[model samples]
Target: MTSREQPSRKRPRSEDASLKNSLSDSERETHEDLIFIRPMRPLSVEPDRDDKFWYKDGNVVLVAGNVAFRVYRGLLASQSTVLDDLCSADPAWHVDGCPVVHMSDRAEEVRSLLSVLINGKTYITKREVSFEDLAIWIRLAHKYRIADLLENSLRRPSLQSPHHSITAVNLARLTETSSILPLALYDCCQLPVETLLNGHTYPGGRVEKLSADDVQRCIQALSVLGVQRTLAIVKSMDLSACGYSCRFECADHVSAIKTELLEDLKSPGCRHPLCSWARFMGQYNRDMTSNVKNSAHPMCPRCIKTVIQSHGQVLLECWKNLPELLGIEVEGWATAQDA
Candidate 1:
């Protein structure tokens, strides 16, 4: 047989007294310089009893993080295919008379999912799902394959702010729900390059970011949206320009609206193309009203109607084609104009 070198034995966690005794003081100091890295330990399976979700007659114990929820296996299996498969597997451990199944999820996430599964719509009196609540509910619902609950969450989304737009996009992608992507992606396009890179932090200090592909798509949207915004402004002016006397009499007033609109679109800073334009829209509205109030060069009511109506019409068309502009395809997407 060819001579083979034996593998060296690893030092025990406790220092070896015989090995220490065998070394001289200088040798021991040199040996002490060597560091022994401990192997990673497995995640803890043992969990503390949950105060609210634990039941006396529960047959299976779901351990999430450090909390355990003893809920019915039958009920969970009935609602979730993933849970059904998990329940059928033979558990390697048991707690009380119940089998202990380790769940790699936060305790709160598990609790939210269970709350809806058990209580149905009565969990909240009005069933108004907040953005945070929707986020928490949808993630676990999709992970567990609870189709009904996922559908329920999608239908009642209350995430009306741009702050959670990235989270909304992620959730939509995760659940394959395309209806939310158009608005969410448009909001993402509005974010500054810096904000897109740094990402938005939620209430719990968790940072939400777009995927690399989404970042690329958002970047692509910036220039296209800038061009579209300019075109829409131009088209609105054309369609809304009044016919005879009002057009000439309030020409300066119409000119002011166009000037402010164009200037608003040219705002600086690290904004993504046309992003800052929408931010100052209220300023335009204020200026229009204040000019009339000052009696300086008030636009005729008809002249004002031209700017407003044609602008609204052009924007309605833009809204319809928003998904296409961002290179996202959202099936069954429509603004009220379509309705």
Candidate 2:
């Protein structure tokens, strides 16, 4: 049994890499004894060997979809005890003198998993991993009991990505990746209802959808979040009395801000009112560059002193109640700061 040494987890690594969408050189390579084929090109039931993963000295043939990877059994056995059992149990099924293990996963998924196992390009180490791709990796990792791979794949996804939509909440539910749920659901609430129902578009315009149950959850959660948004607005709406009462601009701006906040409640999405509000006139909306990010109501020193103080507390409290709002109970789920 040939083996490849696993990489050190403590090693300092940087520069995230992405899953390659297309092969660099020729998608296929020919050899006297072996021929390598890129997956998803479609092949016969017998399947074709992978262009990148085939090794001349491999002891096992792992078939996934219509593609195969001829790789060392010991290398896999070293990573996952579950894989070790599978590779050894089916010795009676052999291909070209190497034992065959047929997998139900898609060829592309197997390719990604093998790449991560062999190349050390994991979700955390990768520069950017889309939620869809990460979901796939996680499913495979769980199926195979690949502890390291599952641990890395389970790291919090980039909720800030526009493509991070309701699909994430659904995936989190399906994969039992609960830590991702609270924020993922919160992020979904920020989208317009049409967008939430239809889902966000990736670079290729691939739109992920939500399950009916999740759709219902989000709708219910949005209504609850809307109340939170209202409370935040009401908390700050009384800023006119803070020594700036003599200034008519303060009253005028407060009125304008109140109207905008009220409109947010009527809007089709979660306004994220607290996070978006600043100590300045960010609610009043004057100028972008000059107004400063998360600006306060103008010339109101009291607002400057206490706006974030109140909003930050509200944001934390909102996050604390998130799992309950979504109505999903996760084992050992704990609330984090402003998730």
Candidate 3:
């Protein structure tokens, strides 16, 4: 007998098939929504309309971060090879059909650099530039390969205050601006190592800034110079030549001066006797040229004159060895020629 063929059974559809179909419908709806949605407007990076450098008729816009500068392309090209090459390579950077160039630089820095290039004058005059501003200007000038700006940056007044001196030293070292090193290092030697390391806060909460390595160098250099300075002061004293002809009185006076100087060495700070002597000598030299009487020392006039001359000689020796003391080379390093 022939067995009845078993009825064929159909295989059940997988739950995965239904899930996939639902996902496809959802994806289709999402795509349709995306197609209907309007694109967000591009953010405007342009500076204020009232900005001094902002030109309504400018042919090119330079965007540095969130700020945009409207300036002449020819001016930038004339000043910087790097900028010229960048703009030349990219002909399609535009905003609202106006050619735009994007730069990875701070707006303030770009503004300063552009101001100088366009106006033929720096935003801050060379005599009034702060350490921070000078540092930024020099760095940007170097980065943009603007040799004129770099040279102009170097011509700015050397650090005038001890706090700025710390900043100058670090900036000079960081930027490899060898021309500013000698004076900066000399100023640093006037300040205490603690002040150099921890920094001194100004009246407005602005703190003097220096690198750890620079602080260490200052400490080492000052330590060496302290010995040299003490020797200079002692050698400069002439006990026999004092107005007081009595040997005992002159001896006592010399001993007192030595004692005070030694005490200052024990707790050297910005106001240390050595710094005071340097300042006094500086003033004396200036007064001598002007024939003015501004000597503040209690020592006799003859003694004071001799001491200033001796200090001058000592400072000359220090200047000659300054680069070596700081563990750097003398070649290409700047020194105060008048020093």
The predictions' CA RMSDs to the true structure, in order, are: 14.7, 11.4, 19.4
lDDT per residue as tens, model 2, 1-339: 113265323211121112122333322111110112123322345778899999999999888867889998877887775566556542435678898876666787788788777876433575676566677777767766677777777873543464465667766765677777777777777777887788767555557777788778878887677788888777766654455434335555565667776886775554674474563444334344465522454435445444445566667677677788888775555533534
**Residue 11 displacement (Å), model 1:** 44
Best by lDDT: 1
Q: What is the alpha-carbon lDDT of model 1 when measured against the actual structure?
A: 0.67
For model 3, the local distance difference test gives 0.60
Of the two candidates 1 and 2, the one with more favorable TM-score, higher being better, is 1
Steric clash count of candidate 3: 0
Give lDDT per model, in order.
0.67, 0.64, 0.60
lDDT of 1 at 108: 79
TM-score of candidate 3 versus the correct structure, residues matched by position = 0.66
For residues 1-339, what per-residue lDDT tens digits would candidate 3 score against the true structure? 111134223223243245335556644443232222222344444444327667877767776657777777766666665565445433334665667666666677777676667656445463366666676777777666667777777777645666678777766765677766766766776876677779878655658677777777777776677677677667666555434454223344445666666677666452222333645543433225453433322344445565666666666666677788877665744344343
Worst 10 residues of 2 by lDDT: 28-37
Q: What lDDT score goes with residue 261 in model 1?
A: 63
Q: TM-score, each model?
A: 0.73, 0.68, 0.66
